[model samples]
Target chain A: MFPTPIARARPSVRTIYMFGLPVSLFIWLIPLLAVMLTSIRSAGDIAAGNYWGWPQGIFLVENYMAVFQNSPIAAFILNSFKVTIPTVIGAVALSCLTGFALGVYRFKANLLIFFMFVAGNFVPFQILMVPVRDLTLKMGMYDTVTGLVLFHIAFQTGFCTLFMRNFIRALPKALIEAARVEGVSELRIFWFIVLPLMRPAIAALAVLIFTFIWNDYFWATVLVQGEHAMPVTAGLYSLNGQWIASWHLVSAGSIVAALPPVAMFFLLQRHFIAGLTLGAVK
Target chain B: MADSIAGKSYWHQNQRRIAPWIFLAPGVFMFAVYVIIPIFQSMEISLYDWDGIGEKTFIGIENYIELLDDEAFYTSLINNLLWLLFYMLAVPAGLFMSLFLNQTVFGIRLVKSLFFFPFVISQVVVGLVFAWFYDPTFGLLALIFKTFGFQPLAVLADERYVTYGIIFAGLWPQTAYCMILYLTGLNAVDPEQIEAGRLDGAKGWRMLWHVVLPQLRPATFIAVVVTVIGALRSFDLVSIMTDGGPYGSSRVLAYYMYEQALSEYGFRMGYGAAIAVVLFVIMMVYISGFLWSMYRQEREGR
Candidate 1:
């Protein structure tokens, strides 16, 4: 929009721009295309020096089924959902209240608390790794889905709070004041009034947190040790070790692992990008 | 239905006394317990010598002294610096990609989303993909090298290139993030300003440099902040790709802390805590800067 369509004749260059789009896209997605092609190739094709050639045999079904049956990939996918869902709910709920309070209250420590959440969100996970893992172990929650969920909830609160606070701050302060004048208790006002207005913010945070916790690898490795609790990210890495020369299976498994978040992104792309680009524009 | 101001003392006292602290409790409590307190705990623990299971022996500053002399620590620190420097390139590259895709061509939305796919997927997968891509025998790079009549370099296995190899994988996702930021920023640019610039015959990179870059400051700042944090906190990719292998050349501070605290080398919890404290201190500088900047912006808005 900002490019100002030069009113003078530039038809040839515009046509060239239109024509060049697809070629550029094709080049951009080369890595993904390679992975897709490799996933359908049979092992025999890979071994037969057919890396980039047309696949002599397509084994998409066989490779996908093999990844599930041969490894604990199904269990891993289930574990990812198990860890992801609860954290999404917990972090969003907590931040809604926190965001509301920070947005609505004119307290002395308001910015102090807000800045704490922002800073905490940016700190490296390593600084918290030793203590968090040890705490989880002491509570007998290590290697459990709940343990991962708890840590994620606590950790994600930082980013969610930042997003939610800014969002609530942008809402019309008049609405809350009008409700307050009608003698609505603050708690009910939050439950019935503010919460209903937060649908967009909630959707954004939910999609973002879902992708984040699902794709998480560090905590999955630190907290969980066995096949039962491993997420796809860790499971895929371990599988890569076992399938030494099985590029076909590896590519299939990678695709399978990547599908959920990719699907989520497409389905909720508006909210997803909205959530990501916070603070990008004035 | 209005509660008149004649008897406002009751409501005023209640609001003043109770509202803020009640609202602040849950968030502040969780943040303090999970984030703030642990920082001090790590600092305190760093003064001791223990393997996590045994009683901590207070050995004042020994870990710090050793870190100053440790070659591995130096290597990890230098690698972190390299990551920070190279990672900043994503900002300009992302801006260029955003400009390329800002047009309204057919299915451009889908194309944009596909370009962003790397950011949504886990870095672990990105690492695995690159590791396979760089495999000396059958990797894409190896295959290309063979076609050119050259020997394949074992990138991950080679000590000199291992850190750089891992950084390349990191840049993939990071660049996607920056592109999205710039795209969003580009969406908000004023059309009239561009029209005025065009009327003045300002075109090409000059128009972009003067008219565009000034408006994109917020986007640039956010991109730089996230990139710096991502580079400094790069642990997962290193862990997944090389596991600090080939003489631990790829050990950034975060991964080094994990290896010391949890791996087969046995838990040097105190030393690990020391390393964590150092990383935290460095990160605090950026965190404080971000906080101060935001605080000033908020005040100015008020």
Candidate 2:
């Protein structure tokens, strides 16, 4: 509305504006489009220096199959799921309780605790790197899936709590007050009254956390060592090292590693955007 | 039976006071152990000298002293400064992009999603994509350079261009993120004000500068905050694309810290901790600013 809608503009300007949209989008997504194209290129195509040209032969299925067969990529994808699903459940469940407390209560330390979570969420990951790794090693969970999952759950709780608390704060308070006046226990109030209203927040947080933990490369490298426990991001990096000149396989693996989160985003775009843009408006 | 009834009544009376603590206990415990306590631990670790697996020797401020004379440390610091500066460009770039795509044309929603596709993918993939894009022989840049009768540039292999190359790759997704934020903010803009500005003959850039931007403060603030954090957390791209290579010219503090403590480099845990502490201190400055702003908002809301 601010630029004066094209509908009211001169026919020439409107035509130009409409034509410009796809051109700009094409330029913007060129990198991804290249990779998507490269993933379907046959090894013969790559070897013949046909990097950016139309592929003479499509090997989409073959390249993807080779990625799974020739490497530990399947295990990596499974590992990603194994780590992501638990962290999502643990972090979201914990935040619901924390959010309910901070949002509903008027306790003396309410803001203090809330700010602690907020502040913790923003600290750079490097500061936590050394100690967290050491802690993981000492717990005998080093290079294990449980170790990665636990740390992710703990670290993600900070952001999830901040998100959940702010969401709960915006809800109507009349129902909560009415339920409290009826002598319902606080736990039941949270379980029955509040939790039912929080489905959207839960869904939003779940998808966001799933994407975040799924794409996590840093922790996967730091805490895990072997192919058995490595998630796809780190696994893909290591595989990149091995398949030095095999751009086709690397591109296919990259796409495979990125698929789950991309799928999640398309499936839950509304909740995902709702979660991300929470603070962008008043 | 009377005692049981009394117990139930007492619980009913005190539940309100006790409920918050019960709700907070698990989350607080986990956050403190994994996030809060480690911050202090890293600060303490910075004061010592240790390999990760062995005993730590206390040599106060020695790591910091060494960092002052270390050329790589300075290089990383400068590169980080460059990253912070260049990353701010995403804010305006995103605003421009959002304005360009703010129309209500057909299939606009799909167009917006396609534009936002980069942000949803992992940084590792972005790095890989850009690495190919900057490939000296077969890359798009090479093709463009060839068309113009210039030499192909191996961007990641040149020390001067490596950091900038990686930063440009980082900007792709970051700009997308900011664009999405602005698009959402644009949705909530008051149409009445835009109409009023049009009536006042404030059209195009004038309307944007005078009327639209003031309403976009929240979006701008969020965009700035996330971009700063994104710039600082630029380890993934550096790791994947260059590995702080071409004679370590592209190393930022985050990547350098990892190199010092982990990787195939000798595990100087204490030195790594020192580097992390420096990055942490820098981040804390912004963190405190953000928290202070939030505090003021809370007070006003109350």
Candidate 3:
């Protein structure tokens, strides 16, 4: 509204907006651009104090290969998938059922349970740290990807349930009522009627949860100790310590660690935006 | 026949009773065990002194008393307050970015998504990027300083500038998040209302203040909620960038709790739990406000 439509604006103003867009984007992405450039820099370029200059040689592949072959980055990436995929599935499946129940039913404790999930979702992980770790140890799931996944699923359910319930509640109620009148069991109504209609919500939750879990470093460090089950987020930290002055290798590792979620956002751009901006548009 | 009908209707009425619990059971169980129960357990554990390896001994309020006098703890608390205050710059910055990017120019969508790249990546990566950027010797900032005839400032190494430095790194991604939220909010602004306001010469700043902002309230709420939560959960960046180093000057409650309980600093589980409890109490205030508004919405929708 402030700029008005492009065609209507004065030619000079239009020219300014067009040129300003890319310039602002360049400034906005300076750190990222610097990192991207660093990732491609030859070690010689770094030594020669060409930090912001054009790269003397492209070492992108060599740097990436170093991260994978020289370090445990490959294993870390596999571990991330192992933790993140199950979390997305388990958390989503649980929330669908819970969301259906809370969205459709009228009973005591309905709002109470809903708010419980809401509150649980916002709580800082520190409160659950020692106890959850102890519990994981007792269950003998400690230091395993499964241990990490289980906690992620359980914790993410709080947020997923909040999302799913709100999404389902916004659906028209008459459809469920009519299904009930047709002698469909409540379970059938949930399975046939509600679940099928929740595709968008499911997609949104999947992307959101994937990003959240993939980016999780705290729990990764707390629950798992060794490289055997370390996700890339934590792996990058270890790599960070090890690389020390090796800027190129560190940059490559950082890029590798950032790729999955970045790819996820790009591939699922629409759904990702929908998921992130869920409450914003309303 | 009437008695039979009454019994059947009663079952139908009570079916509603059965449905919610059935749906809620698994989620509630998981939430209770993993979240709700642990919160209380942590609170209880805070009353005792235990090295994660040893038998527990009752410490009562000693941990809190020590925390009261501990210089590190006070520094962490003040840094957290600084974080909360400085992190809020994301909202207006986000608003400005959203406004800047909210246009129909060609390739704008791709640019907007690319701008959001930081938020999607792990904070560990962001930390690394910033760490390198602020590196005293061949880093970008140092390079700039060299050209200007000034010695490089080691932001992470200098205790005076360290916390603020880490927070600046955090704001990069956080502002991107707020930008996307406001962009969406701007997209959904009522066109008719903007036009209506325009008829009365309500243009530019007046149009935004009167017509657009009221509609953007939901986005504003979410931005504040996520920002507050993000400010408090300042562990990953602190850990990745400095590990609360340059003499633990960058520690926040979240990081301090972990360091005290789990890290090489020694696992004072009870003391750590006490710190966690304090953080939990702080979070509860905001969580309650968010929940209260959500409850009102749910009731209204019902």
Candidate 4:
């Protein structure tokens, strides 16, 4: 509403603006639209240079089925879920405790510890890549889903702790003080009081981490090498290599790879945006 | 008995202090091991020579010295700078898009979400989509080039256009991300300021430049930080779209480090660690600045 509402504009200008909405959206989503369409097209259409035209016939079922039948993408999708879910749970749970400590306590190391998480979160993955991979290998978890999950949980805790601490800090301090005056044990206060208030922060962190771990490519390639453990990002890359010019299959695989995070974002749009824009708003 | 009773009383008095550490222990331990320790370990590794599997040889700064003379190193470094520059365009582009879409209208929520659609999907998908779109023969861009009486540019295969091409694909998602940040910022912009600007005849470009943009500082700061980070982390898209092909013209330091350390180029883990250390130093410059500012803000807020 910052640039005067459309309703206040002259009728003709308003009409033009309304007309432009879908037109501009069409242009914005053209690539995605193309992929969506191509995902449903027959290989024959692509081979015949019918890339932009309506498919001669819809082969949506066959194209999608072929992506699963002819590739390890299913296992990759499973691996993505297997890695992402645990990371979300682990990171969010760990941050809740750390965030509570940093947010509630007046400990001497509070800001020091909080800043460590903040700085660690911002370090480029390459710096962490070599040693993390080596440690995972040494732990006998290399190329296993467990290795990826543990590292992701550890790395994501940095950002999540930052978010969770800020959120917890904003909660009413009196509530904790009142509980303390009543002689409630610290753990009980956390479990029975602060934990309930942290639901929104936890939801936000969960959605954000789910998308992050799902869409992750760098660590997937660095830590996991086998067919059983490759997440969809790396799996899709391998499929791209194998499929060559078969756009339909590649498009189908890409759609499959993208679906979970997309679904999570749509389902948790409010929490997702809340988490992402924590510092953007005043 | 007296000592035991005193010990119990002492533990009771200190439980408040100890509880926080107990809460922090697991998260801190994991972070130190996986994230912080590796940063120093990689730095130390950079001073030696070793394949990932071989016995380590101490050759201090030799890799860094070799990097000084490597043409590919210079190419990736220059490309990263260009990426940093080109990628900043997302901030302005996002502001413009958010301004265009800020009005109240029917189906605006859907429009906003759709506008943000690209970002929700994986970059691998985005990279693949763009690579196909820029494909020489069957691609839409190629068709346009053909219709214009010019040979289609095989962007990924061409060294000159490859980095720009990949950066453009990257911008698709990045621009959307910035738009969301600004959109949220715009929602928090004061209506009173806009009303005052309008009453004083500040409209269009003047209104945006003088009245609107100052309020968007936080959004712009975040947009720039994320963009800088995104530009430096330009690995997935490059790996997916071009694989640093056409003789590795498209390699950013991240991709090149991976290539040097792990790729079929042979596992020069020490050299890769050196490249990582360089990237880490470059990042620490920005990271520390951001932290200092945020720390100041935190103290002031307290």
Instruction: Evaluate every candidate with DockQ and list the scores.
Output: 0.64, 0.84, 0.77, 0.84
lDDT of 3 by residue, A211-261 (tens): 999999999999999999999999989988888777888888888888888
Worst lDDT 10-window in candidate 1 chain B: B1-10
Q: Mind giving the per-residue lDDT tens digits that candidate 1 earns over A1-282?
A: 555442332888777777777787776666778889999999899888677678887898998988889989998899899999999999998899889888888878789888989999999887787777778889999899998888888889899999999999899989999988987777777889999999999999999999999999989998999888888888999998999888889889999999999999999999999999999998
**DockQ leader:** 2
* CAPRI docking class of candidate 1: medium
Tell me the TM-score of each prediction against the true structure.
Answer: 0.96, 0.99, 0.97, 0.98
Model 2 segments more than 4 A misplaced: none
Worst 10 residues of 4 chain A by lDDT: A1-10
DockQ winner, 2 or 4: 2
Q: Which candidate is the best by TM-score?
A: 2
**Residue B108, candidate 3: C-alpha displacement in angstroms:** 0.9
Scored against the native two-chain complex, candidate 3 gets a DockQ of 0.77
What digit string (tens of lDDT, one per residue) describes model 4 on residues A122-211? 898988888888899999999999999999999999999999899988999999999989988889999999999999989988998999
How far is A71's C-alpha from truth in model 2 (Å)?
Answer: 1.4
Model 3 spans with C-alpha error above 4 angstroms: A1-3, B1-14
Report the lDDT tens digits of candidate 1 across residue range B20-125: 5776677677777777777777888889998877798999999999999989888889988999999898999899999888877667899899899889988877
Native contacts matched by each model: 0.64, 0.78, 0.81, 0.81
Model 4 residue pairs with clashes: none
lDDT of 2 by residue, B162-229 (tens): 99999999999999999999999999999999999989999888999999999998999999999999
Model 2 chain A weakest 10-residue run by lDDT: A1-10
Which of the two, 2 or 3, has more TM-score?
Answer: 2
Evaluate residue B271 in candidate 4 and report its C-alpha lDDT on the 0 to 100 scale: 93
